[model samples]
Target: MARYRFRFVACDEGFLRTFAGSAWRGAFGGALKRVVCAMRLRPCEGCPLAGTCIYPHLFEGRQGADPVRLKSLDRIAVPYVFELDDVVPRSFGAGSEVTVTLTLIGDANRRLARSYP
Candidate 1:
């Protein structure tokens, strides 16, 4: 397991609404998919690379190919989580900054470095 922190500074004026967790998650997921998806399939269903792709494992909660695993367990939890500040402001002006923490659990920490480089 490993934790990483990323900071983003607004180059221009921007508004981040209260309870922006979903927005952040959506943006992160979309960007990650774009970075990792090789086939660029929309649904990602029946793709030959589904078993090995990091996008489905991270975003779609896909399980491994082991058949002995519990049938009742459908999907596993995502291997990463986003930690946001407790008191997020409603908006930001130029030069404003926000810090987001990303924790990679289990195999995710190992895959992250290899996935990109």
Candidate 2:
């Protein structure tokens, strides 16, 4: 059996009240709520599809508003990628240097990370 997972990430606790409710405003309703839609993805376990779905987050940035559009969602300032690189393998220093990436998931939750290798 394959294992995929969905995580509940909290960026703004106060705006959550708007996300859980079922309401429609118009012209693509409440902006904050739509921008935070979540999902689970299958991690590649040596699958050929990995190129399109793993490693450096084979899904990161692209237009999610073609098949579906979210109004002003791009304006949402949410950190998407959080990376910690250890120069000394965590044996010394304070902690691994963290690289926080701000990204957008394309339609179908797909897009290769812009960093080449």
Error of 1 at 50 (Å): 1.2
Candidate 1, superposed: residue stretches over 4 Å from native: 65-72
* TM-score, every prediction: 0.82, 0.20
**C-alpha displacement of 65 in model 2, angstroms?**
5.3
Spell out the clash pairs found in candidate 2: none
In candidate 2, position 117 carries an lDDT of 37
Which 10 successive residues of model 1 have the least lDDT summed?
A: 63-72
| Clashes (N, CA, C under 3 Å) per candidate | 0, 0
On a 0 to 1 TM-score scale, where does candidate 2 land against the true structure? Answer: 0.20
